[model samples]
Target: MSETYLIDRATVLTMDGATGATPVERSIRVHDGEIVAVAGALDPQPDDVVLSGRDRLVVPGYVNAHTHSWEALFRARLDNLPLEHWMLLSYPVLGLAPLSPDLIRLRSQLVAIESLRNGVTTLVDDVLEIPGQTEDQLAAVFEAYRDSGIRANISGHVMDRPFADHFPFLADALDADLRRQLDAVTVVRGDEYLDYARGSAQRYADYAGGRLRFMLGPSAPQRCSPDLLAGIDEIAATYDLEFHIHVLETRTQAVTGAEFYGKTMVEYLDALGVLNERVTMAHGIWVTDSDVEVLADRRASVSHNPISNLKLGSGIAPWRKYLDAGVNLGIGTDGMSSSDTARMSEAVKAAALLHKVTGPDYRQWPTAQEVLTAGTLGGARSARLGDTVGSVEVGKRADLVFYDMNSLAFTPRNKPELHLVYSENGSSIDTVMVDGRIVVRDGRVTSVDERAVLDELQARGPELRRWQDELETLNRALLPAFDRQYASVMARQVAVDRYSGRGECWLN
Candidate 1:
């Protein structure tokens, strides 16, 4: 049993969701990894360990709704590429490389450390290509999460094709034999994928006492056939698990799907009976008003990755449309290769600014407090872990972060919540506790040897880069043929000026 701990003298932001309120100075009591009570000043029990929290803001740890930790090694490689080119050029290269279990574990550990330092206690890792890649290699990732002492919802990527048809360049770049190999690649059936995911989740759930959960991650409408999507939905229903899928990320995707299926991607998924409360779609940037209405009607959640969308030249998501339509909305850092950073506070600020610039009036924009709530509670809700870990309160897991108030950025703190969302960054986080355990203290990770991990990653990262570069060179060698094929396909498929009136396309 964990010992009782008393965290005193801090401004506690309960985030109970009843009101958009400020943090109250109070003491929090934790026992057996659960918050037992919170008061203005709780008396420490005989067995309680008292921790000083002077001049600090204590709030529930941030939840990262969408992420791909393996992409950390591919940082700075996909810069300046459009959405289609980036995926076509980068994903296949990274996916084909020989990443050892040690390297995979190391990369995941680095990502966990980055999140811990930023006060993110929970992560939803959207992992693909785990089956062909050895089980031991995948287990290494789980081990890293355990060692980091953070909760995770790990999903195995289930895709039938190596590259979807939406990626015309990559599709056209494949030679006849390579194309056959890509077509011959078979993913685990939805039932089989669920079995693997459940086994992994149960192992980690028992090991960490339910700190880890599994979700059904269908690799989007384009990558998945109708039968596969339906199978995934049925499996999720059978296991009572949450489901995640990438939806309507680019105009190209929407256009391609419309041309193929005579409906938008969201409509296609809906026809297959995949949209539901248990489903969360990442990057609904191309969603139409009717799509938003369907999502709201079905009570499905959407994760808005503002940084990633902007970085990939994907258009801005209709934040006001989702919010006004009563759709559940959350925030995510899509992946390291796309977003370049995993800082949630920065995401919050970007969300606010994105809305302000896109909306009809700046005065009616989402405030810092509202964006912070979306990052915290809304994100947890999207992951279906809201009741347990989203907020600070009695009967909830004691996943909390303590930020030092003495930072130069927060010197003249008029409003702690506002300053936290708007002015502060990860450096202000002095301590991070997940499930009542201090995973990070004094601005350093405690569960793993972070410096050693960084050293190993830095040493071995070049080899990974070499492998990636080799793949890129192979692809570049075939670029001329690919360019001609892409031109023909775009001329026949892509709809130019479809979004001509949708504001100045500030995303680019």
Candidate 2:
């Protein structure tokens, strides 16, 4: 049955695009799942649920613009590694193995719980573990999101190549059974990728009644061929869905793309007609000024994952460039394994501070308000849900977070917005509401058995770790053979270079 709730006497930070400039302290009345009123004159009805907002600040619930929730269970396992090595050493070890559906479901639940507890109501996660493992595994993830009382945009990861060419040792170490499973699977490309994305969207659209959305993630330019990318864009447009892809995450990727495609990665994608308003590019760490201009021209969005970039030693993203170019931007934690935490408030501060370090003048640094907007509204914009979910306002979904203003972090708060961005972390989130329902109250999640989820995560950690360790050891053992194979390839390349009279610079 539908219900009505009135949250009164709160200083609301209505991030509404129309009302962002002037937010007033008022009572918000939510009917069913949508906000019906935001005024002082409304009288409470007899059956309405009234929540007191004494000494609390109400703001829009955070939107985690991007994540890889499947990596949540693998946190802290690959710390202190460079970006290339992290992907080389950790991706296969953590992702390529045959994980039980139970483990995947548990990990998704843990990740969703972490997000909800921290005041994040929506997540657009890139779950690209293994191709064709999408059906039951993805359903399990959606079930976790539903049970956790969070909204999500989930997509299966698609890759078109065997690991041997990229991570030779990792490929060779895969058992015949695993190899057969991988090889026999049909690659998601062209119409296949489109069909999968559209089907998933329709299914989840029905499941959420439009609450839980689905997106088309093409993995990245390197992982996807041109035909697949074009098809993905077409599919998203046809279905009116959001499109996500990784771009310019590292210099190696950019250099490789330029060398292979005779154009920059962004330019290549632009030529393929994949850049548009509906597209959100994750990472974008190594984007050039021209690239930023192209994105701006296309009205595309950029997801700034400051912690993940720093953790992996990827260069800081050009936040100022994007802002100057008028590119819509948002904040993300990337993934638990890459970020080690799912705290969006910390991510907001990181975004502000990272720009301060890279920019020439501190005065030009991103402000707390700007960072907060990026985390909430910008993320909503990236997900194409800006009008509905990003802000606290009348006639919108009642997605909000309540922070205890009495906390030490917010003591004598001169600027509540500043305190939220720079001082208050997730611990200050006293209550969280999504779709007018209180999913978290008094810092405790109300939807799931928190202790049992924690216990399951703890119990499952060791087995996953053991499997990862075994895979790493096997990869190490096969490294010598891979080295020989690489040497052979290099020798052949050198011979071709010599015959062509291109000399040492030929490879470059």
Q: TM-score: which candidate is best?
A: 1
State the displacement of the C-alpha of residue 419, model 2, in Å, after optimal TM-score superposition: 1.0
Counted clashes in each candidate structure: 0, 1
- For residue 67, model 2's alpha carbon misses the true position, in angstroms, by 0.5
TM-score of candidate 1 on Cα atoms, chains taken together: 0.91
> In candidate 1, what are the lDDT values of residues 68-104, reduced to their tens digit?
8867877888777656667655566323645677877
Task: Please list the C-alpha lDDT of all candidates, in the order they appear.
Answer: 0.77, 0.76
Which residues of candidate 1, in runs, are more than 4 Å off? 19-21, 93-98, 130-133, 162-195, 201-205, 477-508
Put down candidate 2 lDDT per residue, 198-231, tens digits, no spaces. 7787787756656677788877887677777877
Candidate 1: deviation at residue 440, Å?
Answer: 0.9
lDDT measured at residue 411 in model 2 versus the true structure, 0 to 100: 91
Q: Which ten residues in a row are the worst by lDDT in model 1?
A: 496-505
- Clash count for candidate 1 is 0
- What range of 10 consecutive residues in model 2 has the weakest lDDT sum? 494-503
